[model samples]
Target chain A: MAVLQILEYPDPILKQLSKEVTNFNSSLETFLKDFIETLNSHKYCVGLAAPQTGNLQRIIGIDISRARKPHLNNGLLILINPKILEVSDFKIVREGCLSIPDFTANVKRAMHIVVAYQNAKGEAKILSTKDFEAHAIQHEIDHLDGVLFLDKISNPASDLFRRVRY
Target chain B: MNESKNYFAVFVLGTDSPGIVADISKALFELGANINDSSHTIIGNQFAMLLLISTEPVYNTETIQNAFQIVTQKRGLTVYTHQLRHEDVYRKSSEPGQLCVIHLYGADKPGIVYQVTSLLAKNSVNITDLSTRRFGSESKPIYIMYLEAEVPNNIDTRKLGSDLNKLALSLNVEIKYELEEVASL
Candidate 1:
């Protein structure tokens, strides 16, 4: 497993917005692979975004393959320029971030979503998902827009919990 | 950056009145003691102040306590100063595993949280966060307690859910458990 350096909180790169990928090429492929490698290295991490790693490109990798129940092993998806087309009902879920590694906060998110984006093959597609899948997608998308979960936290008092694992 | 210094806690109690905070803070500033953390609140007819202070070059708690003797005699207040060792500081990471919210609401009664959490603790579950609130009328008031706990891997929630279901029936209180998943970024 490749051990990539993780960016911590208050890092300028983590706050910078990502640029949309216009073309699917070998460089994009390599970045996607490295992203997967870095994510796997963090056993506790379920996903990663491009801006977080200083790429500044609109790319995100998520592998909820091992998630509970039968889930789509999409393994890795490279969304060049994904946009949310539809969202249904807000759902509250506690979320932990790799950037803010030691803290967990409750966040309200879309229960279901339909996203439009371009695939690695340069083909455009739309995908719909709910539950954890939808939540993960929305989180990565927020990172692409320079938004952290701390930004999306609905109620600061109800949402944020300090890491005090003893 | 300067060298790390030790901290102390000062306890001050006097009759409920204004100017307590100003008076205490003024003394600390004059003594060159930094207030790292503090909780000053009035409970009942008395005002209680607990100050977590730090001093460079480490000052004596007795010195500070003695300095407050004049205020104590003047206002009939009780003042105490205590030094804290490194062991006194509690710093640790939060609980791991799946953190879930448990909401219990029922008629005003004792031992609601006791019975529910007693079972959870017996099963090795840890409570990371908790809060409670009371509402409704006095004659028919409702006691509502909200608790957030972490579920360890060994304990599958299905079993806990079933057990809680049985307890809900016995206690006649509504209990709800919801998973709190960490979202990736």
Candidate 2:
């Protein structure tokens, strides 16, 4: 398994809408291996979308357990062709992206969400998540639709803060 | 004079009115200047703006000042320009640190800014941006301060919080702060 390069913003590919995953073939298996490796390579990185790695496929890897502070999560999640079935109330949370790397914005996201997705084996699964995990899920799902947190900021001048890289 | 662009720090202030930004930007654009960073806000009917502009090596601070002469005369705005050294352009810290946002509000009084900033300075906390406003009834004014700062890795955050609490008590103000966590997704 190898760590794939995360494409930063201004790269036209990052804005391209990711395609749905249809075939769970050997190539998909190989890509998943590299994707998981890349996700686990960074410290405190909880989630990564397929488009971030320049793969225009509807897939994301999330593991809030890897964060510095303890957060209630589903341990490690590899979601493919993920779809948000339902959502709850909105809350503001400061979010930063690996691709953007320069600024963090207070993005309004659903506090609770119901998601339907497929696993590595192409088996359908539904996950009901809340809090930080739900926020991560929404962020990753947006990547599949070519939407970045910058687009969802409540107030551009006030809510956006310069990111101090750690 | 060699080949690199010249950077200038430009400050503009005047009575708040429409067309301030349009006139200023048009001047800069005609001068072939690129605004690298800028922020403008209205404070109590006064329009204040700060801009970091870069021009070709041929232009200098004087050139920028001369370009704004029309706007200054027409709108009665005060404009100042100072050239900046190249080394100061990109001074990002090599070592990363924790980012913190501090919010403080209380009755209007002097020394509020001094007391809090002094405490932050003693702790090696670098203030990145700060804005303070006075509001509420004229008889009972309320002062609010919002600050964004970078805390060095060497500092103890827990102790800092307690210190701030003590300062809040002494100053008789409500102070709340949170360390910004960037969920790297």
What TM-score would every model get versus the actual structure? 0.79, 0.90
Write candidate 2's Cα lDDT for A1-166 as tens digits.
Answer: 8999999998888888999999999999999999999999988899999999999999999999987668899999999999999999898777888898888888888989999999999999999999889999999999999999877876667777766544
* lDDT of each residue in A52-124, candidate 1, tens digit only: 7778988777667644334554655667688999999897787778899767787888988999988877799
Worst 10 residues of 1 chain B by lDDT: B86-95
Native-to-model Cα distance after best TM-score fit, residue B82 in candidate 1, in Å: 7.4
lDDT of 1 by residue, B1-185 (tens): 12477678899998978777777787788888888667676767899988878887557888788767666776788998888876564346344667778898889687787888998997788887677777899889898888888787668888898899899889898989886555545
| lDDT (Cα, tens digit) per residue for candidate 2, span B41-108 | 99889999999888998888788899999999999999999998986664467655667889999998
Chain A only, candidate 1, TM-score = 0.89
Q: Each predicted complex: what DockQ?
A: 0.45, 0.55
Off by over 4 Å in 2: A68-70, B1-3
Q: Cα deviation in Å at residue B47, candidate 2? A: 1.3
Any runs in candidate 1 off by more than 4 Å, and if so which? A1-3, A66-73, A154-156, A164-166, B1-95
Candidate 2 has an lDDT of 0.89
Query: Would you list the C-alpha lDDT of every candidate in the order shown?
Result: 0.77, 0.89
